[model samples]
Target chain A: MSDGPAIETRGVTRVFESRKGFLFREKTRTEALKGVDLVVERGAIFGLLGPNGAGKTTFTKILSTLLLPTSGTALVLGHSVTKETAWLRPRMGLVLGGERGLYNRVSGRENLRYFADLYGVPIAERERRIGEVLERVGLTDAADRRTEEYSRGMKQKLHIARGILHRPEILFLDEPTIGLDPKSARETRKLIRSLVSDGVTIFLTTHYMFEAEELCPRIAILSRGRIVARDTLDGLRTLVGGDRTFEVEAYGFEDREIESLRHLPGVSKVASEEYGPATRLTMRVRTRETTLDDVRGLLPGHPELAVRERRTSLEDVYLDLVEEEAT
Target chain B: MAASAPAYTRARSTVASLRLAVLQFMADPQWLIPSMIAPVIFGLVSFELFRGYGPYFLIYAILGAGMMSMWGQTLYGSGWATGQDRNFGTLEPTIQSPTPYLYVVLGRVLWNVVSGLFGGLIVYAVVVGAAGQPPALANPLASIALFVFVMLTLAAIGVVFAAFYVYTRYAGFIQNIGEFAFYVGTGCMFPVVLLPFAVTPIALVFPPTWALDALRYVAIPGYTGFGWGLWGDVAGAVASTAVYLAIAGLIFRRVERQVLAKGNLSDY
Candidate 1:
């Protein structure tokens, strides 16, 4: 509701310390987030892509005011998440959905009704709003069915319904489409778009590269508790090297042939690695001037060489950044 | 300062939570079976022990049995629901809502009092059946009202103990171990005046101990639990219960902050 960014963090960190041993207790502190800084604008579907244990959920939990950061600060709607939770909770929603997090014995409608009251939905429109969210999530038919009988996809839809039932200004969805079928995942993505169309800022975390590329105009890649890169899709495409890559494979390449391939037009960088019995040279080209034929021409001595050109994708950028951080 | 929900909002949430508890109880009434076991056993055993002592002794047997039933249903029932929340993974979403979790506990305890009264009636029937007659009360109406008031005091205890469940998932196990200790310490099955002087201070800390003592004064003829009589015990009960209610908010705030810091809200 403020003019500032919808979500922002400054050097936020979270460490989880657990104790073991009944008598001489031993402490184990796992730093889940290490000095992460991020900014998300309003009305944007900002995608956060990270591998397992990469701190995506931790950062989201901090931003949503579900967990306090061990150090630094996080602001949602320009209010401190730790200090101003009362103002933040009503305006924000979260979906940490699974088979759990639901009243399995109650009907989906009943679950929404309970949350509608807790969220303080207007008495005049509580039932109507629940109906709208259920319809939007494609669960009208299953609305009265006990949630324990719901399929994984149906339960997920119900989770989404409860999250948007109150119509929060921002929503934090951690892997909303994780366990859904292909069709269901696509429909979930469509729902995300519709939510953004309604002017709700979305902080989405997922492992689906294509989903992030398709939905988020801006994205961030988190690796091992740290954010390695954050930018527009094209911006991330540029970060790893360029917008195009050519994978040239041959049994082996001579020193001169490898050196000559690197000098080709628009080639910004060349990386070599063993692929099965052959050696693959990955050339990152920043321009359209380089073609597969141009690469084949340079290595004519090896007629068996296979040249494959692929446009740079978010997945490529993600792997490159995460690996870069790892090394 | 954090913004507080409007009074109406809090009240509505509390009512909604109470409704949810009722709905859940209706769906699964089997939980009532375990809570009934202890009270029925106590009623039968105490009736046998107090038989033929005196006409007033039957009053002790009945009040002691009813108090045991109300004790479990009010304190243990409310806390168990929170343990179930941890199991259902409902704790996190409920905690995340703008409505403070304390109101939710209040709602559940309110419903428990309803169920606990049902439990108290069942125990009363069991005792009367064992004794082959109903216990005579000097003032039945005042005793009934005071008995209901004693349930409210037990509710204060419930709300306070519910904070422990929110603090740790293992709270149910600890409560299980401490259940008998709570009964003996609070003197739910006997008069606190019979306890050692050193232990009386600890027993008086629980509002139900004083409230039950006051209820006895009005229920039993020639009964004097304390030298000052019914009004004195009533004063003590009201003051102690007020203290419990006052500190519940502070305790819940600290527990909530601790769980959030530990990131253990979802742990079961």
Candidate 2:
């Protein structure tokens, strides 16, 4: 159907079987991806965020056709990845494992041309495109230089250039800015945005939450081979919404006095802990509704008490979600 | 980047890729020098040490150096290339491109062929030409055809070896074994006939031995004093090397399938 996503995986799983020891080793199995289902619309910048060893690379490999899923199916640009990989490979671009995704012996231009050939770029048009990509990545002058001579940021740019050489409809960029300086990282992000604007569907994976928040319209948080959450930034932000907690420092407060604050309306739970000679009271409430109104009514009774409110940010929500899942 | 254009643009790209590989070879003085120098040293040492066997010894020694050059370059260059791929993380990107895997494999093999030719020629110019017993193929065109056949067989072997290297992702372990095969099976250190006849079958399994035999037969045609009919043996070696090439291709495919199934293609 015309409605098919640019990239989709349904119940995909990958298991690695390896042997241990030297002479008398037993077989070992590692489950890298487990029943993961993902969908990215055409031209969408989809972010896949996970901790290291959380199967982000595994998922990228599967989508990029470098790997086969043990138990499920994936489609890239409407091509079935497992069954028709040869058909899918030409239209898909992949930059996996950062800067090492290059032929070090070849120059930047040569690397691009090599990929262009792999993609079946017409012979007549390859030269101009090669020049274009090199210039675009600002590696034109260094295009003739061996990749071994490239700086880390230069290598990353070359990697990006190689991935887009074929003008693929979908791109899988794994840790694209992994080792880049801040300026280069910003440049890479801008280039990624431009690629997206030109109808290129980008499937990006990174550990940088802020990058995801800035670039990806939708993100899936992965941990332990499972996707914990997949939603738009605002939608994910709402997932952790409920109560704002405040540490109310008072001129004079006792544990019994903190208990009095908890008894107020809209207060869900209250805990008091000692800091030096003072009692720090943390309260969890039930609404975005001003806790100050309740605190005002309660604090006036204790004339010496000071009231303050602390709301949970997205980072706190993410940590809490991951921690909660771990337990 | 430039404006996007039409499809079907690939031939120039493939050539460009080849050019890049060649340029890289020229720049790496370390590999370039050793790849050429080692064969010359082998040729000179063998020529000086053994002269009692007459022209047979000198001519066949040159053939041995030739086989060593081809095998050395193919194995060493390809092995180092495989290592560089692992180090640079270039494998995944190339795999993701629209190019067929076979084309990429061929591009790599072609690079090895170029390196072999350059290195072999250097050794030939030094040892055979200087000794005044330079090789002249009796059936020059036929010898060319046979040389290609033998090289393809060896290349297939290289591919199987390269695939194993890819799967293991070990740095230069495959090259070490390749270096061992060069010395023992290809008769680089000594004539293959000097190896026990019992080992002939095993040595014949390696393309370099057939390659050496074919080259010797071509280079030294008339003097079959040992009762070995030169051309007949050359034809037989060609046929068997073809068979070995087919087997190597099958092994390469099998290894590729295993690596894909295991999902360790990018392990390094």
Candidate whose lDDT is highest: 1
For all predictions, the C-alpha RMSD in Å is 2.6, 4.2
Q: How does model 1 score on DockQ?
A: 0.46
Q: Indicate which candidate wins on TM-score.
A: 1
TM-scores, chain A, per candidate: 0.95, 0.83
Indicate the residue-level lDDT of B47 in model 2: 60
- Chain B vs. true chain B: TM-score per candidate: 0.92, 0.76
Model 1: residues >4 Å from true position, as ranges? A252-260, A272-280, B1-8, B35-42
Expressed as tens digits, the lDDT of each residue in B1-268 for candidate 1 is 1133312288988999999998888777586574567678878887887878887778888877877778888999888889889999999889999999999999999999988888788778888888788889999999999999999999998888889999998898888998887788787877778888777888889898888888888988887876668888889999999999889889999989988899988889
State each model's CA lDDT, in order.
0.87, 0.69
Candidate 1 lDDT over A103-156, as tens digits, reads 988899999999999999888888898989999999999899889999998899
Candidate 2 lDDT tens digits, A181-260: 99989988988898988788899999887788779999888878888888887666556543476667665565566677
TM-score list, all predictions: 0.95, 0.85
